[model samples]
Target: MSEVQELTKTKEKPLWYVVFTYHNAEKRVEEHINSLAKTEKYDGLIIKAEVPVQKRTVSRRGKIKEIEEKIFPGYVFVKAVMTPEVMAAIRRINGVAHFVGGGNEPVPITPEEVKRARIQDDLSEEFKAGDTVMITDGPFENFIGKIIKIEGRKINIALSLFDREMGIDFSPEQIMKIQ
Candidate 1:
């Protein structure tokens, strides 16, 4: 193939690269890259930016809430046809620490890794409220508890402690449904 043909072939397929950003700046970096991608100069070279996140349930002060937590904090995945200009522009963006690779060149992430990172854990579908579960890990191991509430991946269970009924929150991995 001719040099021009090779270049065209390469540019046709955008690759996913990992960009390291400042603390708590993943979203900012992703937005900046995506906005720049829409501009004429970067229209074809920069495809899109993504910050993989998963829904999480947290109980604070007896209140259950669902939150989106970053799967990889301080990192953003950018899909683009990487070139010298594109890489330079990304590095110049605020909050972007650097591209994740050796030396000054950025390395593309494998498709398998990207797919794995995007997978969200939906543990709430496996168990429901009012179900009996046994604590599988932590100090409450082997203890039986009744599920009182389930928020995303967090499960609130009521169990006997010190002869008193109390509620505690646990992740799906920390509890198993009683058959």
Candidate 2:
């Protein structure tokens, strides 16, 4: 390639950067960036917005269910040529917390890390608070409990064990919802 062509190519090439968004708001933020990129000004400056997710399987009442989980909750990856205008536009989107970099400038994620983060890990099961479930793994295996709270993959349950009430936390993969 000619020197000028090489220079322009390098300048226009997009790098992967991480952006923070409100928990569970990755899709919204991605759509917002997509709309903005379509505008006349940001057309080529912003390239892609992605939310990496994985499929999981869980059993409930003898039935299995597949669920999609975010690999990095509250964060999204964007491929774009870093520029003041592009950054500002992304920052202005609702639900965007900020770029992952702590300082004044944004830091791009390494190509290797980006590749790893994009891999989908499959798992099983989904449950909600107030559902009765049975532990399938961990120390409480075979114990029946009622889900009292759910935070990401962790589940807090209230169970009656040894004639007393106890509260414990477990991962969704370790418990099965029972009707």
Candidate 3:
């Protein structure tokens, strides 16, 4: 027998695409998609699913609560090979509105876009009571104040204006620590 030539077919490459789901149902839709893919044995097509979220601190009645907020509401990012079977499987999941791109075709997002969408909290810096900070923006621009209270991004600062100490709220973007 002569030499035999074997022909092997390659599968489609996976790319990151954005999926639009019901409002406030990103987590649920992700779970459902994952469950469906697993049970239906389409795990190779649907590689990964994620919902970009950010930690936010909210203060109410003197109590501060840390909550995880989705960076993109009603949207979830999925990395997969967009095959007809994979698309059909995703459509069957509840709470899944449709892919971000119109029509049956879904568009892939750039890696840079994915990074930008993921809003991570920078916890390296900390401000405490009596710490001096400079107001960088807003009405208190160029003014110096002492930190009265620190609630995540919101800082309650006491500024001396006209010989009177007044407390004002400033976001992390509006203040820089001096000491």
Rank ordering of all candidates by lDDT, starting from the highest: 1, 2, 3
Off by over 4 Å in 2: 1-10, 119-179
Write one digit per residue (lDDT tens) for candidate 2, span 1-179.
Answer: 76434443344445689999997889999898877767889866776688898999999899999999889999988877789999998998999999998697889887578769973211122356688777777888767788888775567899898899898988655765554
- Give candidate 2's error at residue 178 in angstroms: 59
* Candidate closest to the true structure, highest lDDT: 1
| Model 3 per-residue lDDT tens digits across residues 94-120 | 788899886779898875786698723
Over 4 Å off, model 1? 1-12, 119-179
TM-score for every candidate vs. truth? Answer: 0.62, 0.60, 0.58
Cα lDDT listed for each candidate: 0.82, 0.76, 0.73
Q: Predict model 1's lDDT versus the native.
A: 0.82
Candidate 3 wrong stretches, greater than 4 Å: 1-9, 119-179
The residue-level lDDT of candidate 2 at 85 comes to: 93
Q: Between which residue pairs do clashes occur in model 3? A: none
C-alpha RMSD values across all candidates: 18.1, 21.3, 19.2
